[model samples]
Target: MEATPRPSINIMTALLLLSLHGFIGPAAMAEQPSISADQASLLALKQHITDDPEDLLSTNWTETTSVCNWVGITCGTTHTSRVTRLNLACMGLSGTLPPQLGNLSFLAYFNITNNTFHGSLPVELSHLRRLQYFSVRGNFFEGEIPPWLASLPRLKYLFLNANGFSGTIPESICNVSTLQTLDLSENQLAGTILPLIFNIPLLKVIDLSNNQLSGAMPSSVFSESPLLDIDHSSNSLSGVLPQNICGNLPNLQGLFLSFNQFSGGIPSSLSECRQLQVLALSVNNFSGTIPRELGNLTLLNGLYLGVNNLIEYGSGGVVSTRGDVYSYGILLMETFTGKGPTDEMFSGEESLKRWVKNSLPDAVGDVLDAKLLSREELTAAKLECVSTILELAAHCCTELPGERKGMNDVLAKLEKIRTVLGQM
Candidate 1:
């Protein structure tokens, strides 16, 4: 699980909080402060918090003090001291949100992440017109995500991950034009994902992983979407992946579809996802030869094809004697460079083959395994033989499948190199 992140506050708000409490409070001790509607709403919310072992709210939220001075409260500087942000993330508070909180018209950011908050989301939250960021993630919230969430006109980031939200995701959520990130992972959400959700104009990240969602993904064209990362892994989804999955999502970077019942050949068109860095298709019923075109994605750092029915392919996209040569070449590089193809260091236009190719022939020693070079009896002949092996690996890893050397030729070269080393 990712660590809960703190929301960012403006410098002006920080300064205002400091000035009101640090400097002004000492001089205004004798004046009487009146409670506003925002204050009443906050106090009402405080009433529902059944557990506060730290006495955070009991000691700080008092009738005598201005609500602006309360912890997790930030009043807007221009909205006549109206509460604009309430962040109680990871505070260990347990409670349900009060409907009265919807009255805070100026609220733009609200977060109660990693808390024990339970019960379905209050429908009153639909009235938060100015709200931009809302997170109730890592909580005990249950029931279906409300359809009224689409009513928040300005909502941008919506996170409800790691909860008990069930039922089909409301298709009405596609109405949020300004939404950027939507995460509903680790939930009980079911039903097929609607295609309109993928066509949301500005949506960049969509995570629906670890859910009960089923059915084949709609074959609709995802046009004009700037989506960067999509994780639909660990679901009951089935059917062949869309043939034109990358046709419209030009900025797609991560495609994680593991642990599902998806069948049929992996789409060859996926190679068009030029920005793709992580491609995970493991633990599925997918069968057929792996696409050789995938080798063209130099930026790809992670390619997981384990626990599947995929097979190695030879030239012209068929299983043959040369089918296993490409993998054997990668094995040679791995043995020499002491690096796997998916090593963290080989991201963004770099791979085990590319790394070795850059330092071949003359500088091969630099990329060679240290243990091999450290042998006291190792001679220049063995070093040259290693260089020859890496050169063979380069031939096998050519971007075009037909250009790759056949397994027969590769084996013949390796045998000659071994014979030469033995004579030395």
Candidate 2:
């Protein structure tokens, strides 16, 4: 629900609209000569909302007063007083838009958020080529996303979230090359998210969450985009997410694909996103052990993966504490060796605990912590104590639950090792 960058206003368009005052015919003479293209559009907008209980438009927007004097209207001080920005957010206005308002040639920034405006967008709005930022968020605007918006060259920010927009997200929207932010969440937009959106060079934020967009999102699209935030959560999107998403999109800061049906292992490549601040993949079907590499993202602030099949989700048929022992063994290996059971190095029958157990006694030096090796001044007794600890860890992580030492026995053995180390 982010507001995007406002478009730069065209001063020349304002001047041209003002000069039209001299060309007024005898019939147009009845109308005020000072009323420019934007003022006329404002009057059409006023007509739609005057029937509301607020009477906001009828009270202030009148011919007796200059449009420049109206509320939410900002006119240029240079040559012409044509309106450049019209902000009427949270006004509680209710009605449909008029086609006449598209005549605002100089209009650049228009905000009508937090209103009750309904009905589909007018085709006439396509005439506002100078428009850059147009937001109707928190309204009841419905129907298909108009394909005509692609014709606007200067349009950079389009916010239509929290509406009733339906039908396919027209591929024509990708035609707006200058677009920097597009928010169409919280609607009924169906069909696959067209990949052409990735071509938008300046696009930084894309919130297509809370819709019906399905199918696998292409990871290759992230390779070149400088996207700062991507929220595709709360949808029905399915399929395995490509593992290279984090590596491909280096500048990515936030990635939200939660509450979907995505199924696959948590990508180990996610460790490459050094700048990632938030990664939300909760309530999905992601499998495999949590990648220990994810701990590498130093800047990561949020990590949500609830209700997923990380370790276990649904019933695993017969349950036992043996699973706890298995988890404990994995944790023990990961804690000391700093490698997860699901790490790329451990595949097929190989695992972190198995590897540590294999190199016991003789090769304990090879897998032992490098910091422990640095303790060169230590006596041989301490080294023997370290080997005993490794053996205890291996015993806790035996392949069979029946063969593994019970918790009480493991604790007793740990105490014995502690006593031996403490005496030295």
Candidate 3:
């Protein structure tokens, strides 16, 4: 018969009820830290971005938006809703990273690859104990790689390549037991590689190429490691390669040592790496006949042995390293075609050997350099001699190193060809 009288409350009681029911406006809620530490850190980074040509962060990342919804920001869903991953790769965003980024205690994966971010990496980054994958590749970041990076207890992949980072690679980085791949290529890093780097138990790949590193390789390097790929090319590393290079490295897949000052005979034990797919030893000062045992590497696909001083076995024996045959084949092709293995005309799958091998028997004239023989000098006898040399080279370039021709056979055939040419 009567509606219940509405209860009256004081202004303070009304405000308390609204707050308890979450009916208060953002202006009131903002009084108690609406922005999180993660948001603040991200904002600090945004302030350092001098150029955001794509407006990726400039437009999407704002205080009005939820930090988790921002572009390139991924927040955790299962547990605490904190920033867990920050990936801004290839956005053309130019900026130096802010030290406040270390405040993202939950950050796990961080990548800024192929951007123009420059300046030394802030030491505060070492605070990211949960970081798993950290990459800053293809940027202008410089200064010595900080030793504090080893402090990341959970780091798995670290890519610091294609930058201007100078100074010796910090030995302490090897302390990361969880590191799987460490790529420091294409930098200005000098000094011999630290032996401990090769000893990390879980390390699978080590790329130290295209730097200024010099000095002999550590004697204990590569022994009993699980490394699958080791690239030390385009450096100043000298001294004889270890005779037992493939020792205990059952998983070795690629060994790139090109464009260095490495000398002495290639280790015959390289044949032990049955899984080896690519072996690059070109542009070095290696001498002595290649070990015939290399032919045993049945899985080898990419073999680079050109530009070395490898010669016929001084013993004049029929047995020669299988690698020597491949080198000789490449040499023969270069001599006739005047094209180096690194010729601009050759790249990717197309190589000097492949070019000559494909042109053999019928299209010999096509591969011959004009400097090698003038049109008038290209008589039938001369053409036959040239063809024989190219044929020998093709045999040396066989896909399987073991299946390639021996140097003894190659030398004899070459001598006979010369004899015939001289008589003609």
lDDT winner: 3
Single out the weakest 10-residue window by summed lDDT for candidate 2.
312-321
Specify the highest-TM-score model's number.
3
lDDT (Cα, 0-100) at 79 in candidate 1: 51
Lowest lDDT 10-mer window, candidate 3?
312-321
For residues 304-381, write the lDDT of model 3, one tens digit per residue. 786677864321244445655666577677669977655678862247767887887778888899856879988877
lDDT tens per residue, model 2, 254-293? 8888778999898888888777877778668988877879
- For candidate 1, give the lDDT of residue 211: 100
| TM-score of every model versus the real structure | 0.68, 0.66, 0.70
lDDT of 2 at 93: 87
| True-vs-predicted CA distance for residue 94, candidate 2, Å | 0.1
Which residue pairs show backbone clashes in model 2? none
lDDT of 1 by residue, 1-424 (tens): 9999999999878777877777666544422232377888889999999988788899999988888899999987775677899999989999999998888888999999988999988898888899999999989999999999999999999999999999999989999999999999999999999899998889999999999999997785557679999999889999999998988888999998878999999888999999998887766898988887898888887676645676664445555544355655665776688776667787532467788998888888889887456666557778888889999988876766678787678879989998998898
The backbone clash count of each candidate, in order, is 0, 0, 3
Per-residue error (Å), model 3, residue 301? 0.9
